[model samples]
Target: MTTDENLGKAAIFDLDGTLLDSMGVWDQIDAAFLAKRGITVPDDYMETVTAMQFREIARYTIDRFDLDDTEDGLMAEWDRMAHDAYTSIVQPKAHALDYLRYLKATGARLAVATTMPAGLRAPALGHAGMLDLFDAIVGVDDVGRGKEHPDIYLEAAARVGVPAHAATVFEDLLAGVQSAAGAGMHVWGVYDESSAQSWPAIQSIAQGVLDDFAQAPRPLA
Candidate 1:
């Protein structure tokens, strides 16, 4: 699509698995967090909490495994464990930065709808050189819900000053795709190794699907 075609359209992106190759960090954290309490991560645990808000994940974990940690305590522990990694080690997905820049330069409004913690959002995206690329960034906390619902995506569109129909959401997980599409936005599935199990379903639902940003659909019909 030409720059003219992109005018007035908004692009909403998810951070962790979609634009950033950071799901491994969370997986490692989950394993470590469980190990600290003398257990291993259950096979279904990751899928269950993948799209939940940080606080929701904490509460669910505490209840599922009977962990003796309060929601605040667990969240604090996760923040401590994740802060340095995000600022120092996390990286973006292949060609994600270039694609975002191209879209922005072509006049597409860009926003982020992510499950990333509020405190870590800026530092993490900044570390990946993505902090300046977005017109708006809204996290689960901002919408008071996770990707399992359409609230976060809707908030991002609202902040971008675009109607849902004028926006397209790029997501790696099935839940994110489902939620964003439910909000009446166009949806494109971005493939991530972390979400490989759900790729087929995502492909069925997303209007377009690509494993790399370089292959992301242009014009975004």
Candidate 2:
């Protein structure tokens, strides 16, 4: 755990798996997409795209399946599918709302930096009853790059009117954590047992690993 002072800290969160229990939606989408085409994806399909950008996942699926649709069409289809699924099944992660409220009550600036399109992120946040919680909501379009690049977190900090070094990023995917860490923010890696086993360099990059946000330690005075 990081003993470094947490003064002037802002908290930026990755939306999907970190704040919402929605990682399984991706696997369901992949399975349904492949089954519609009469091809079966490998069991590790979700692992292959664990932290992938939406466009990257669409491209990979297109190439792997020899999909006849244009990249634009494929992305549209997937986006629509995800939106539908979110409306129907997605739920906030355990203690997610409570954590956000706690941050607000403690005067920690809150923001969401996600690879998901704003169209999706906006409604999902509202659906989860968290739309008013964030000071800023940043999507891939705001950064022009995905989480693989550190620009996303950097831009997120900028939007939140904070410097990267003073931010704490809550991330579920290793790639997202790496991006935040690369941008000089302290990360809190939220573990999902179904998706990931271990992150070796977490001790170096993250403030701590949390099974849920409620486990985050109180800020040091």
Candidate 3:
């Protein structure tokens, strides 16, 4: 449970598995990309790159599989493969819209802090009717670091005109929860099937854990 004192004045949300039920799209992309090169997706590959940014993932894939592809080439291919799904097939996580509306009605500033690239995020959020709901969308490209660092979360709070301690971050991954908490913001862990292995760590770090956004405490009037 998140007490009123911990609710904060701004809400920073993670995109993929947190607010958008879209991790499965990435799984399909990984498998298909590897399959195209006559390689099977390694069982541990997705886990290893779970918290990485697009460029990082590209570099890792090229090196790990001894592929002859440049990072830029791989990234472009990935963006092409996943763009349509992000813009059309992806949907909000259970009750995510309701919670966003609840926070909006509370007069709390809202922002997105995600590792997703801007090319994918913009259309996806726009199609989902969420683009205008946020005060800002801070992507991994903006910070040049992954969620293991507090850069993205800190910037999101700053952009939303909230102190780090006066913001709450809703995240679905252990790395994201740690990043926001490391930035001195309150963290609320959202459950995602893709992150099941890291659930215990997320529970231990977050101020609250939610299987669904509907379970979130109502914003204070």
Candidate 4:
């Protein structure tokens, strides 16, 4: 676990699996999308797209399956399938709100750096009553690269007025944890059943791993 000395003045978060219990919604979207075409969702498809942006996922889906659909078309369909669920059905992960509140009370700045697009992210965060809590929300579109690069995390820390090394990033995916750590930030990996396959890798690299936010170590005195 990271000690108080290692904690930063700003905390950067990944939305989907880290803060919001919404990865299941994406799984359903993938299943429903492929089902419409009479194609069963491949077991490895979700894992392959776990850290990709919408457009990247769209391109990968089309190429991997040899589908004739345009990238934009696939992206629009996924957005349509996910919009309502994100805005209405998705909830914050266990103890997430409490953790955010604790950070806020400690005078730490908060920002969301997520692969989810603005159209879906804004509504989900607003519905979860967390939209106003963040000092900034950086989406994949905001950066030139995805989580495989450190651009998004760097931008998030900059937006919140923190240096990369002085920012702690909360993420659930190995790609994200790697990105933030690559950017010289301390990473805390949150657990999600959907990402169980990568837990060992995540644990090995992250400064800390949290099975639930309730068990998150206090990062401030």
Model 3 TM: 0.93
User: Could you give candidate 2's per-residue lDDT for residues 93-119 as a string of tens digits?
Assistant: 888898777777777778888877666
Q: How high is each candidate's TM-score?
A: 0.96, 0.89, 0.93, 0.93
lDDT of 3 by residue, 1-221 (tens): 22343244888999999999999999999989999899998878877897788899899999999999999999999899889998889999888888887777667888998988779888888877888888899987798988888899999989988898888899998988887888789899999999999999999999999988988766621
Which pairs clash inside model 1?
Answer: none
- RMSD, every candidate, angstroms: 1.5, 3.8, 3.2, 3.2
Model 3 misplaced stretches (Cα beyond 4 Å): 1-8
lDDT of each: 0.90, 0.77, 0.87, 0.87
Per-candidate count of clashing residue pairs (backbone under 3 Å): 0, 0, 0, 0
Model 4 clashing-pair count? 0
Off by over 4 Å in 2: 1-7, 200-204
- When 1 and 3 are scored with lDDT, the better candidate is 1
Better of 2 and 4 by lDDT: 4
Q: Residue 198 error for model 4, in Å?
A: 0.5
Q: Give the winner by lDDT.
A: 1
